[model samples]
Target: MLVRCSLLLPLLVWLAPAQGALERVDDFALLDQHGEFHQLSRYRHMRALAVMAYSADCPAMAEMAAGFEDLGHTLSDRDIAFLFIDTQGLDRGQLRGLELELPILDDGGRLVSAALEFGQAGEVALLFPERLSLFYQGAAGAGFEQTLDAVLAAEVTNSIADSIRAPLEAGCPLEFPVRETMLAEAPDYAGEVAPRIIENCGMCHRRGGVGPFALDSHLMLLGWSPMIREVLLNKRMPPMQVDPHIGHSRDAQYIAAEDLQVLVNWIDAGAPGPAGEADPLLALAEAPAPGWQLGEPDYIVQAPRQDIPPVGVLDYTYEETELGLGEEKWVRALQYLPGDQSVLHHLMSFVTGEGEDFWGAERRQENSTRRFLDGYAPGQDLLREFQPGTGVRIRPGEKLSMQFHYVTNGQSTSDATRIGLYFYDEPPEREIFTDAVSTRFLLPPNVPEFPLRASRRLERDAVLTGVRARMNFRGKKMKFAYQAPGEPLREIFSVPAYNYGWQPYYRLDEPIAIPAGATLHVIGAFDNSISNPNNPNPDAELRFGVESWEEMFTGYFTYHHAH
Candidate 1:
């Protein structure tokens, strides 16, 4: 019986290089349960090998393990190796305790899974050495037995299996042919590109940046050398909306392709030494004071102060205040400065009519606060000036509402928030629009990890676009793509390493061109088990809600409708 194994592989392989059949696993070293090293080339000479990806916590995988063991026993006489790969995000300690009987290899970095196209968690592939073909492929269910039988009996040597496995050798070509471009003289790293990197990528890629690794120094850059080149060439790094032609820079995360090429070329040139002693990056730094990136504000709106207890997970809290904007004012820029920066993880603000308050709503919802006018997170500086023409209008008698989600670092703390606004007396030429994309999905408690996606096609085509997505601590990855009316779908933005504490609105430098009927797709994956360290409750059934405690799938899209 033909089986479907699409859902069985771990989804992380979505970022792997494309390969045809018979692909050789690339160079990657990972540890096994016993802390032994497992290299990709170890199984190269085996006549037939079964690479089974499994997760100990997943019940479906536990059931599949039995079949895999049976198949291993059946294929034992044929000298075929049954190699199990653990794609669960477990460290060495947790993995060793599971006692999986098979020779399991840890693919914690996901390099092997990505190279082999075993994306789902419990998928199996029967590999043949002679022709380097995938003789059988399927999920961890009952139907996998047929594929196992076929592999043992040698009955699946047909063209389909041959086609699937034949291309593995040609799969990721080790060499990237250098291209001859207009600016081919290998751009200077420190001079030409480091400034741009500081401006766009550095804020998060630095020593204390929100990103996992730092890109502040040449040594660090060399450490992640190749991956940096690959992600940029694949348009994956800098993680911004790609529209190189139009749009005013609204966010600090946007990087231009030319800037990317400079870094790529710099890395390609072995990251040569800076041309002159006056370091460009240091020269460019207009470092702000200790507490704020932007100077003190014209107006400071403080939230009612609160003291955080030491040593426990604090429930979501909200504080409300009234900002009496006596008359209409055009805000050209704004900045949010936390009274105590270390404990403030994120803050959100909302504009409300004088009488409509979030305090009442919070009371109704059994909470203490109201909605916020804007949202800000760590690594996010105050809102800066847009192109001369654009500004957010604050009208008289309009109350500015604020909410702060504070995460403590095991320290007793008190926080009083203040926001500064830079106003423009004259109206601007351009306008900004902020719209949200959300989904309705119920998450069952303790059901191993699963995929969740939500999408909405634009009713009418809109041109410039920016997005903000929110998920509880368990979010794994999120992506925003656009399918133009008659063109192929293009991924505009993706957050591969999602952090609950630092959510930033990624803006496209060049506004994306969307046809009137183009559709926008937003997808996100959640890991809601104890294994997912950030999951507040390993056994809580999650459902749709706006509260910070509940799970939510929402995409906030700010766009300008075409005229």
Candidate 2:
């Protein structure tokens, strides 16, 4: 069973880099209640190693017994090794009554417990022994199931497990008698921890922002410490995390190792605030400016105020306004000013003809004209500007159709968002255009990797400015490529991992020039299996549809004619 024990450990040494936030568990051995030597090295061949920190005296441990038992059966069938380590200093007499059928290793010295640093009962750490790294360290809950599914997927695909997957443990705190002696210094909230939170969390977590709640004071942070810790450890708070090894984007949100340690350490050390100290979070300047970042808009189109109910589903709202352009106008840039940013989910604007609703007379206007002018969503507030010699054209008497998608927050509110456009005196040398490479495919149920492809041949010499991908929950990965005649296809951009919630338009650093006959290709795959944590139903056969619940495969491309 341990044939490659020596070779694998040394080969997987580079899996966990020295500077990462990953807290690797040291290998140790212990005798189970049955006097069977359960060693860590002996389980390297398994898909994963699940270690449950159990305490016979803790009531929380007893409450989690059913969950642990269910997980043991599920993991064993999936080829995952599971075991329990007793952290409490309970004697055999006290444990005999519990009658846990699972293998319970006695950690009389609390050596294994201290090494994993699980503070509470019912916490489990998922380890990938093949890589000699910790895949997930968190409490047993719904989040644990999601993490386990992700681990299993990674195992099947032979992909690297996410380094940060520790959800906050929810259980009675274990009284590690030696822990009190180990904490000699308390982390000051104002001096050490506040700066870190303000830098990383304060932007979205402030009042009237997109965050669910505020973290503007020491008291507020303390009150929400458990949630904050959970999001931070699980790598869920700082959204749209890009794999550092794959590529780097300015929009990527990643927490540094040193900063993460400061927050986690302070929370673990009892979240102390110095006596009579001023709140740093309150003292910090507000991040969002009252006015536009690009000074003032050349022309601002104010959208009609929308009344959002406290609850229930809401349909898409459509509004139109006449631009009344006497002559052609060249728009250089555009920005969205959302009145109630919290309730606003997304906004899509299109330049259509007179009396046109969402779609033109044909009812599918997107196919008729390159009408999708701009879009706005959370964390996608960057000012959209065309290339130096390119701009979007607005003809005389053209109307702007606005489509709003709002999500209720259990409160009655309204939004009057304004679309700001900056125009140039003269038309640019080239006119920018937006096109999409899309396809419709019926997805079979429980298919892990369903490949799809779509391509469009260019009609004119153009420069590819940017690319963006759109898909529903089943979307896994997408890449954009172009093939010139008599030349090999070359991938220009790739979204290795696609999260439905985060769809940012990635701008190319260097624009690619393509001839009129070049074919642009968009290729991707979908995961409709049970392993997909986001899949609404693994058994439901999905088809191409316009609703969010349904599936769609489209890759948006922004380009301009090379006049």
Model 1, residue 402: displacement in angstroms?
A: 2.3
| Candidate 2 local lDDT, 1-563, one digit each (tens) | 01111111221332433333333455555556644444454355466778888876677677686687788897777858788888875554455556887888756556457657777777887776655466666777765676677566643334332344444545777665543432346566788789888878775677766666777888888999867765654345576554333234454565664565567556767888756877898853354644576769888888999999988866567888887779888888888888887677777777877666654432332222365677776665547776677788889989788778777777899999988888988778888777767787799997757899988889889898777787878886687889999999877776655667666666665788989999889878887875455778879998886567888788878888888
Local error of candidate 2 at residue 371 (angstroms): 4.3
- Which candidate ranks first by TM-score, i.e. highest? 2
For this target, which candidate reaches the highest lDDT against the unseen true structure? 2
Kindly provide the TM-score of model 1 when superposed on the true structure, using C-alpha atoms. 0.52
Cα lDDT tens digits for candidate 1, 272-389 = 6566555555532333334445566666777788787655766667655667777777666777766765566677766666666443343233112222235666556556554466
lDDT of 2 at 60: 66
Clash totals for all candidate models: 27, 0
Q: Rate the local accuracy (lDDT) of all candidates.
A: 0.57, 0.69
Error (Å) of candidate 2 at residue 164 is 24
